[model samples]
Target: MATDSAAWICAALLAFLPLSTARAAPLAPGQPAPDFALRDQHGQVQRLADQRGHWVVLYFYPKDDTPGCTREACRFRDDLHALLALGAVVLGVSLDDSDSHARFAAKHQLPFPLLADPGGNTARAYASLWSLGPIKFAKRRSFLIDPAGRLARIYRKVAPDRHSQEIIADLRALQQGHAPRP
Candidate 1:
């Protein structure tokens, strides 16, 4: 009876607690990047397994068309060719639905995929989701997945203005057989 009462109390307390926790620890470098299947702005299903043999830039942003998100996305747009030349594919993920992504991608002329994670499962897998009661959004984070589908680096603190450039430089270094300083 005592143990049952304690368990009941704990469950009741948990129900009353604020729902602000992320899913799990962020994946470490060298771990195989989590596999995800999500529909992009065009309703095309994209899978991480398909991106093998090319560097994958998997970036998670908070919303569609917001200022910081725009800046980060446009920078990637401007540098897309360079990144492609270096065998990289950029993927942007957010909690927005496909309709929102279509508008945002059209408005910004983004050439890459902006994946819809309306349920935030992908963001949660990446340890990038933030929740407050009923509200949730992805934090600004990026994962650099190598050609073998392993995480090369994880950017927990991102500066939107120079993030693409930073990735470009890092890709160059990694391709040249040196550890990226950034």
Candidate 2:
């Protein structure tokens, strides 16, 4: 009985841990970014392949309109002009439905496309989807793909509030042929 109790305690503690497992191997810089054709909040199908020749900021968040996600999306919205001026297009992805994305984008007045990945296919391809028993969602990850559709940088752990500016700085450095600091 004591051993069973200890096992139960251990399992309970594990459940409380931040244990997100990536489904695939960690992607490397200069590798081709995974291509995805997903529907956005506006119901338009957005394809990564189509965004070739322009820098792409493909960000995967866990859900829509949550505190962290909102901060991240709004920061992107607030800084959209800077990103565009740098020849970069920002696409936010989440494991939410189109309706959720629509509401979130509209509520935040986010100008960028918030792509829905309800089935987690895109998230898994980027190695960002995480599952804890029945609770599944995408980890907060971002990929900066160069104009040639190659991964320029991978952000495995991101701070929602500060990520956009981080991308902006990196974009400038990358465009200037400066090596991005890890």
Candidate 3:
């Protein structure tokens, strides 16, 4: 009877599994990024328009201090020098409030700025907002924008362990006038 009940539960879960959909968010490469003005942890404004002439690495994460998010942020912090040397400026965005962001930044010793997207409006504009595991907020997404503001690459399935290395590699290739490999 227990075996039968377990099988029934498995079958029910399989029946409710998500079907593959073609309506996923559109790929945004080669298009100009939408400009934004958001406040950072320090309560100062960060305007995308003001960064027009610099290569921008804009990463949207789910939260401030969760495990996976922390790993990703630390990786970014570790590789910050290489990123800046490649002429890229990194910015992190999440639905975390400024106070939370301040704590996360100070705790992690992050060298770059983190933008606070408390209302989720910025995440929605970038199609990076989602809910998971009872937490309603932004999803983990990263975009590499060129100096002229064209979206050069989007990393949706980023591995927190090696994400910074991957971004650094891509930036190096871009600097060398070569297209990055998949």
Please give the CA lDDT of all the candidate structures: 0.95, 0.93, 0.85
Sort the candidates on lDDT, descending order: 1, 2, 3
Candidate 1: where are CA atoms >4 Å away?
Answer: 1-19
Top candidate by TM-score: 2
lDDT of 3 by residue, 1-182 (tens): 99999999988876676532213347578988878898888999999888888899999988889999999999999888888888889999998888899999999898788999877777877878775323457778899999999899989788989988998888888888899877
Clashes of each: 0, 0, 0
Model number with the top lDDT: 1
How many angstroms is residue 30 displaced in model 1 relative to the true structure, after the best TM-score fit? 0.4
Output the lDDT of residue 13, model 3.
76
Q: Where does candidate 2 have its weakest 10-residue lDDT segment? A: 17-26
- Clashing pairs for model 2 are none
Residue-by-residue lDDT tens digits, candidate 1, 1-182: 99999999988877886777587765898998999999999999999999999999999999999999999999999999999999999999999999999999999999999999999999999999999768899999999999999999899999999999999999999999999985
**Deviation (Å) of 113 in candidate 2:** 0.3
RMSD of each: 7.2, 3.4, 3.8
Candidate 2 lDDT over residue span 1-182, tens digit each = 99999999999988787676647767899999989999999999999999999999999999897899999999999999999999999999989989999999889999999999988999999999998755789999999999999999999889999999999999999999998889
